[model samples]
Target chain A: MSRTRVHNFTISLDGFATGEGLSAEQPFGHAGHRLHQWMMATAFGAPIMGLPGGSSGVDNAFAQQHEPGIGAEIMGSRKFGPPGWQDDPNWRGWWGPNPPFHTPTYVLTSRPRSPLEMEGGTTFHFLDAPGAEALKIAQEAASGKDVRIGGGPTMLRDFLAAGLIDHLHVVQVPVLLGRGVRLWDGLEGLEQQYQVETVSTPSGVTHFTFSR
Target chain B: MSRTRVHNFTISLDGFATGEGLSAEQPFGHAGHRLHQWMMATAFGAPIMGLPGGSSGVDNAFAQQHEPGIGAEIMGSRKFGPPGWQDDPNWRGWWGPNPPFHTPTYVLTSRPRSPLEMEGGTTFHFLDAPGAEALKIAQEAASGKDVRIGGGPTMLRDFLAAGLIDHLHVVQVPVLLGRGVRLWDGLEGLEQQYQVETVSTPSGVTHFTFSR
Candidate 1:
């Protein structure tokens, strides 16, 4: 079945998925890629940094699930680029010509813009609508595969609170980021809707998967 | 060597150790016994509920560490009882005549009162001292054994921020308590000092241990 999913989304022990003060200079702000170092070290995301040898353990196993069966991705504008990316017509993306997401990627932003097709199958479509409407568009674009809710915390929380997610994968990195966008802000009693499973790897990252 | 430790300290995914509005009626407030239901199902803590046939797996193994080497315990006033517990001279504790800690138990409160000795070796001593001073007193009472820093979030954060903790064991309960006392507040960059370990058991609770 085609499901709305999130995979390998990283967060600190304090629940900050992304940090404060996101900019073009530092996309992840004060967090500075600490939250995602686990995923980045995986076999799936490691190739992005041009790293040859990466662990293919539980982390890589989870990271590799991000792409398979995912025909389209719906991410926030912040995940696409830093703040004011909408203003910069020249701003392509943080991930150069060939981005990792080789899917029909939809970027949620207040200001709508024309679609930018990258070298890979990845194409950024600007959407000025709520999570449900955006998901509908992405699901249709997914072509019977599945819609991936790529996140930056705000959009993920919105979808989770809106009960639009089917399967979710969150990596709990041990680092305690004091301040940032939180994943569990409005998700009180989230366990009621989804069955949660936790697996702690030898590399010190606990993978939490929630599926309804 | 004397080591300061915290054990079986349960908190929600959002880092809330306990819920709001704690009282004698509902000691854990809206959270009730949910935060600690995992521990209550363990072989160690299950005995308190007078229940049999609890699991003897990783959860029980970790839960068993709560009372092993510690000679004394220092807990916040909130953990001792409800608000205005001092006002009610009849208020002994939530744990009946034979309280769990069979050692010198120090309760941190602004309003100090005379020591209350229970049936077992547990004796509640009210102290108005800060984390450091209180640690000194507890350490002295410990007589070379380790001191367990029992908590209710605020006091644990204070002790942690003060760098007074040597070993910490936190159980990440799957529940999301939206509003309550947070364990990770003012504890940014906590991962820097402690060598952390994450373990997820079959019972669906993740155990986080930080040892300096």
Candidate 2:
């Protein structure tokens, strides 16, 4: 069965997945790279940033799960770029010409654009649909493999609230963003539904995996 | 040299220390005892609630730190009692005659009342002083022992914001309280000052200790 999974979703201690005032220049706003520093230090994340080597410990073990079985990805439009990305005609994505996603990635947006094929097997498909609708499209595109719920907090919270996620992995970094888009907002009684497992790494980031 | 410390301060994944609709009847409000359930299962916490033979694991290791070095306690008015506790002359505290805090516990409230001495060494002293002044009084009462900053989120945040705390131990409970009093508000860049250490126990709670 093709499951909907969310991996490597990082959030601050105060539950802010991404910081406020996100722009084209500052993608994560004032948060900078603080939230993702742990992942960056991992072997899986280093090469993505063009680094030579990284740690192969607990953080690397979880960070490497981002690719393996993921066939299609459904990301919020905000994850593709900053706010007002739809207004910009030339806004491809933050990942440049050859994006990290080698799957048929679907971007959820009000303004759906034509299919844009990048290098490797990655293809950007825009859709103006809700959580369930977007998941269905992504699942269909995923074929026999699983669909990855790529997020920027708003869409992740929506999918989580709707109980569409089968496997959810969130990295909780020890930092307070103070004000930002909270990932755990309206996610009351979430632990009741899933079998939650938490493990803290030496790098000072706790990984939470909620499996149904 | 008496250091100010905060221990066993539990909060939800969303950063809520206590749930909304807190009253005299429901001290922790809609949150019930969910936030402190992990602590309750600990050896130190179980005996406090009249329970016997609890787990002496990682949770207990952290839970037991509440009283060892502390001499005096400083808690917010909300922590001492509910919202309308000041109006009620008969209101002592939620901890009953033999309160757990066996020290001179200072309650920061606008309407300061006469000292209420309980059966235990816990004497509730109402004060209108700010975080710094309250710390000063608590430190004097603590003598050479360390002073503990007891919380109800607001006061803890104030003490944390004022940089009056030397050690802070926060247990991140897995559950998410949709709406409540947040503890991490206005605490941005907190990690820069303190040497943070994260450890996730098998009880599904992440223990975060920040020491300067």
Q: lDDT: which candidate is best?
A: 2
| lDDT assessment of candidate 2 | 0.91
Please give, for residues A21-59, the per-residue lDDT of candidate 1 as tens digits.
Answer: 988888888999898788778788788987877889888
Off by over 4 Å in 2: none
- Clash pairs detected, candidate 2: none
True-vs-predicted CA distance for residue B74, candidate 2, Å: 0.9
Candidate 2, B164: how far from true, in Å? 0.8
In the range B121-208, model 1's lDDT, one tens digit per residue, is: 9999999998999999999999999999999789999999989999999999888999888999777898899899999988898999
Worst 10 residues of 2 chain B by lDDT: B172-181
Highest DockQ among the candidates is held by which one?
A: 1
Instruction: Give a tens-digit lDDT track for model 2, residues B1-212.
Output: 89998999999888889998998778989999999999889899998888988998889988889989899999999998888888999999888789999999999999999999898799999999999998899889988999999898998998889999999999988887888899998999898899999999988899999999
| Predictions in order: lDDT | 0.90, 0.91
DockQ of 1: 0.91
